[model samples]
Target: MKILPEISRTLSEYLLIPGLTTEDCTPDTVDLGTALVRHRIGEESGVRIATPLVSAIMQAVSSPELAVALAQVGGLAFIHQNQPVEEQAADVRAVKRHKAGFRTIEVTVGPDTPLGEVARQLSATEQGVAVVTRSGDTEGAFLGIISLDDFHLERHGAHESAGSRMRGRAGLVTAPVTASLSEANELIWEHHLDVLPVLDGDRVASLVLKRDYQAHKTYHRASVDGEKRLRVGAGINSRDFKDRVPALVEAGADVLCLDSSDGYSVYQAKTLEFVRETYGDAVSVGAGNVVDGRAFRYLADAGAAFVKVGIGGGAICTTRAQKGIGRGQASALLDVVEARDAYARETGVHVPLCCDGGLLNDSHMAMALAMGADFIMLGRYFARLDESPSPKVQIDGQWYKEYWGEGSQRAQNAARYGQGGRMVFEEGVDGFVPYAGSLYDNVERTRAKLTSTMISCGSTNLRDFHRDAVLVPVSAESFKQTGAEVQLRRPTADH
Candidate 1:
């Protein structure tokens, strides 16, 4: 057993490449956007902006709903494989079938829905338009369209004014289902309409909302798969890969990640080969939880689309302390990145490198990105979100979410480990996490901070950040100096 500190420097004392920024390049418009991930994108590939975030393999942390939420925000969630194949597959299906691709159905209501109800729905979304359809069915016949302003009328029962119909029906314009994004945009502009319902023979198949067109005009990246549905992924253990992979694939999971504390086993190698050969390029798989260059090479050779790196760096992981088989996150990440680049140079295949743990905050995420990680994976962070499966409990009048590692006794038992498989050697722990209101708030805030970091580093896009980022080494004392705070404590104790 060897301590990580003895082997490598930890993330607490590392950095990203810095840059000279001019006032012209602002964080708000710095284009810190990601390519909508469908299949895995390699780090050195021209279109290699993998989604910025992912959730680690914690069944209680990443729920089906959390997976959907993450996808909508240009990230992926590995629906944990710790549950039954049926349950895990359902989780993947929930995310895959969540939102129809190219179809904006977020704000929809029934025709008979009163103005009050409609307004409430409208207020819940940031989209400028509210849609009315039969039975409030997203794909039902279009009834009418309403604007955000319609809800603001202070007249008595102003909500009811929308009535059995809204004013926009008289001017209701729609695009054909076959309409491309450009055609939809053109229709919106030509009709001077704020919303265009996409029709598949009188049924509203989709809504080309104005705001989405305006927002993503430049990048044109939505979290859609080849099916045009929101892209989703699921985790599968090597032991259950044969059974789980097919079910997850059938459920429309666009990618499968090998969910293991360690991914360099012969079992993983065989499983990776099976997925790649059977599914071909139809599905991408992330293989790992290994540390360093050699492990990265092994997974890449085993048909891993991307390699996950990090060992015992998780908040709940005790692998380093108990087993002493983990490396510091910064060192592990750099080694894998180097391996990925070297592999690309030799084989013309650039596998994406993922940092799977030790991201305590946005600063760590920024460092990982600038250090060339295609994406960052998190567990405890997502476990605290309202959408996660972590049960909430009250502690001292404040709410906290339950979080546990896959290797914990609770998880292993739920997974039915040791019945006929591996021995019961817990590598992670169960703990409480402070309540985080929603996935949107938490993920968006992280994204915002990362965007700011990119701007400060004078990089317009993720690729630029990775290519030009400057790592300025600083001592522990120096790093502490930047955040040094002297607290005045008032102790209250029993007499």
Candidate 2:
């Protein structure tokens, strides 16, 4: 057997050499916008993201809530397919139904409902507010609103009906459906109102909360479709593409991705063919988890909108140890990127590359983009956020969120592993990640760091970063020297 001479390398083994800092190259000027699909050379991609990041297709990371949050922050999340088709489609619909500055009246109660039940419903909502509608339907006749501040369970007996405590519509300040978001916000702050229900005739159409307006102000670069709904993606396995594709499309999924541990196979090819034949160019589907240029070329030629580059490199993945069939993440990305450029030169089709998994920090993300990735896919990063579907638990007085791989025993997603109808063994581990606060805060910080790096590299956009950025190999000792040398101070008791 012949062996390659070059050694496999990881992103940590290299460091970016800073370039000239031009006067115009600043973080504000650095544009992270990137293509999410294949397009002809010199033509803009049909699907593009304002940010070059995406959440992974795992049960613990991507959910309807997470999808909406990420889309609002200018990124995208692929809803996992570990469950039934109907459930996944419903999750897609939930994301599609999301309105940026408006809150759907999910927690609603009738006027006669007990305060105890209203409390339960309000507690389940993030806003701690509930609408008191005539028939308890979200769009039922307008009545009033009840919040935690309106009454306390101890002061106002739990047995009291919501009608007894709620502020009636006649006294409440309401906005017409034609009111703009800014106008609603103005009314909310002017009247010291917690929520301004937008009424369509006598029915409560939707509620605009103070916090939602503030969130919109913070994340104004939200990714949306032509209809102004949040953009969301869904993952599909090769085995169920025939049945799953139509349902996801009908449910308003903006894009589809073929999720597999090893996507360079006949199964993925057949799935791509079926999607292309049935939906034409209307459905943008990506495929991957490849480790070489050959695999990249194969998928690109087979009509993959974008190809994911990485294998056995996820935080929870054990494919390399269990099966010994994977390459180094950095090396894998380098090879695929080379092929991608060549393919573009030959056919004039510029298929984007998604650097999936193995990224540990903002530095790694910058290195991935510098090495020629159009976007990055993150599992552990997003899994730690409040938006993730996983529940958080306290361990040793430290909060952690549950994070598991699609191939883990907890997930039992056999279709992702392509191991018959059942999983013979686990190829991933169930674990926990430190709880990071909200998606907006973390994503903003990440964007700042990445943009700062681009500025240092003298690049104002991703295309310039790809062309002008330079990286050099670093020794193990040099890598260690990059961290702090002195002993770190211990945190105070108060801190």
Candidate 3:
């Protein structure tokens, strides 16, 4: 048996050498935009994300809520397929229905509805804002809004009607449907209103909140479809592509990914062929979890819009432990990127490379991009956010969100593992991640760090980072030296 001479490397084992920082190179000028699908050498990709971040296709990570939030911040989320096809399609629809900056009034109450019922409805809604319509329908005659600040359960009687407590439409600030977001924001600020109901001839069309408007301003690069809906992706499996693909497409999924623990096989090839033949170039489908150049070339040739790199490197994955069949994440990405570039040179089609899993910190993300990754797919990172599908629980007075791998027994996702009708064994684990706050806050901070890293590398865009960024392998001692050595400070006791 022949063995390769070069050693497989991990991202932690290397460090980026700062390039010449130019006067124009700054965090504000750095653009993280990258292609999400294959395109001709000089032509633009049909699908592109404003930022190079993607949520993983796992139940605990990507959800309808998370998809909307990620898309709002210029990233993409692949809705997990660990549930029924109908449920998955419904989730895709939920994301597609979401219009950035404007929230659809899910909970509406009649003028005579009891305060207790209004409270219940508000509790069920994410925004905690309920509209008081004439017929209690979303499209009914506009009345007023009932926010959590409108009444207290203890102070207000349960028998009291919402109309009595709600601020009446006479004094409530409302904007016309034709008004732009800027004009609406001006009205909101002028009236000091928390919620501005955009009206269409006395009917409540949508509600725009001050917080959502601020978020829109902060993340102006939100990824959206032609109709201005948040862009979302759906995860499908090779076994059920026939039934799943059509449903997801009909449900308004912007993109599709064949989620598999191992994607280099005849099953994946057949599925890719079917998608290409049936949908042509209309459906952008990506595939992977490959660890080598051969696998990358195979998928790229099979019409994969983008190829995911890394195997057995996810935070919850145990594939390498259970079965010794994976490569180092950094090495895998490097090899696949080389193959991707070569393939582009040959066919004039540049298929983007996504580094999935094995990224522990923001530095790792920067390193991955510098090493030629078009973008990075994160499971643990997004799984901790409030937008994730999982619920948060307090442990040892510290909050943590539940996280599980698709291969875990808790998931029982056999289609992703390709182990027949049912999972023969578990290749992943169920675990917890430190609960992070809202997706917008965390993503903004992460983006700032990434931009700074790019600026340090003297690059203003992802393509420039790929070309100019230089990395050098570091020794185990040097790696340890990179961390703070004098971290002996402890929290002061509160009296």
Candidate that would win on lDDT: 2
Model 3 worst lDDT window (10 residues) = 120-129
Candidate 3 global CA lDDT score = 0.88
Identify the runs in model 3 with alpha carbons over 4 angstroms from their true place: 108-122, 127-178, 187-205, 391-399, 435-438, 480-487, 491-495
lDDT of each: 0.74, 0.90, 0.88
Task: Please identify model 2 stretches exceeding 4 Å from their true place.
Answer: 1-5, 40-46, 94-97, 108-120, 125-178, 190-192, 199-203, 226-229, 385-401, 434-441, 480-485, 489-495
Judging by TM-score, tell me the better candidate of 1 and 2: 2
Q: Against the true structure, candidate 1 has what lDDT?
A: 0.74
Model 3 alpha-carbon miss at residue 121, Å: 3.9
TM-score of every candidate: 0.74, 0.85, 0.84
Clashes of each: 7, 0, 0
Question: Would you list the clashing residue pairs of candidate 3?
Answer: none
State residue 262's C-alpha deviation in candidate 2, in Å: 0.9
